[model samples]
Target: MVSSISLSIDSDLDKVSLLARAVRALCEDLLGPDDQDAVELSLVEAINNVIKHGYHGERGKDVQVAVGLQADQVVIEVIDHAPPMPAQVLDKAPEDTFAFDEADLADIPEGGMGLALIRMNMDEVEYHSGDSENRLRMVKRIAPRSQ
Candidate 1:
């Protein structure tokens, strides 16, 4: 069986936490306790990117959160009305550009590292943009193998 829920909210950093909490609850219930932290952290990072880069610091734009459970996997998607993330952004090697220090965090640039964290925590990550919408989908595998 598959279960899903979606919500649209203003594009704001503060709102990302709410999205994370909602997604985490769905994942925990559907996917079980294993990797719960990883799922929550990934969702938080993805929602942060949707608010920051996707919306380009704009206010009152819609950020959509969708969660789904199918068989042994949990999928979460964050959709925004803004243009898709640059291919280079997603393609870049996390080791090279995502390494951040305290100084870097203090002077946070317009972009860096969030997607890297999302990639690291999720089992699969995909991005799609067309028809005036951008979608970032992440999947986590959840199932126990019998010995």
Candidate 2:
């Protein structure tokens, strides 16, 4: 069986919580607890990036999230009309380990970790933009349920 849900929200940060909850509910049975949490976290991170960076903190802009569960995987797509992601960000690879200067508190970055988190959590990640629309797609593989 397949299940899916879609939500459209304004570029407000407050709206992301409710949207994440809806996606989690829709995916409840299709994923294990850990995977479910990962998906929710990834979903939140994706939308946050779209709102903060893509929309430049603008309100009332449109952001859409769609999640679908198939027999073997979960598909998540986040769409927006804001500017496309930086070329370096789109081209960079996700690192398995996080590296930062522990001794220097100011060296820690306050932002720019969302994409890395999404890429680390999801099995696959892709992003593209054209026609004034940008889309970020992520996938997580799951084992088939036993009969």
Candidate 3:
């Protein structure tokens, strides 16, 4: 069985944290002791990306967040109205993947770590965008170790 919740809010960084908190509460309830801090951190990162990069600092734009809990996993989806990021950008591995040093941080752009962190923490991550909306869906499998 799967339980789902949806929320729509302003595309603001400050507000995104509230969304993250709400997700954390829902995840904690569904996952019980199995959910960890890393999952919460990843959700915050994704929400931050949607508010910052996805909406490009636009305050009034709408950002939608959805959380779904299944028997063995948790899924999160973030939707926004911004233009889709280039496929190549999403495909290329972060430079940090090879060697994450201060030099790499200097060379790479800021805010790029959001997706990298999401991919690192989540079991699956997918991007879908159309003329009207851009969507990021991430899933984290509930592991026995966490339980």
Using TM-score, give the best candidate's number. Answer: 2
Which candidate number has the best lDDT? 2
RMSD of each: 2.8, 1.7, 2.6
Clashes of each: 0, 0, 0
Q: Residue 112 in model 1: shift from native, Å? A: 2.1
RMSD of 1: 2.8
Off by over 4 Å in 1: 32-34, 98-110, 145-147
TM-score of each: 0.84, 0.92, 0.85
Q: What are the runs in model 3 whose C-alpha is more than 4 Å off? A: 32-34, 94-98, 103-105, 145-147
Q: What is the lDDT, from 0 to 100, of the residue 65 in candidate 2?
A: 89
For model 2, state the Cα shift of residue 121 in Å: 0.5
Q: Write the per-residue lDDT of candidate 1 for residues 40-120, one digit (tens) a residue.
A: 888888777777777788889998888888878888888888877878887887776655575766755456678877888
Residue-level lDDT of model 2, residues 38-132, one tens digit each, is 99999999999999998988999999988887988999999999988889876655662257786898877676678889988889999989999
* lDDT tens digits by residue: candidate 3, 96-124: 54454566658555457777877887889
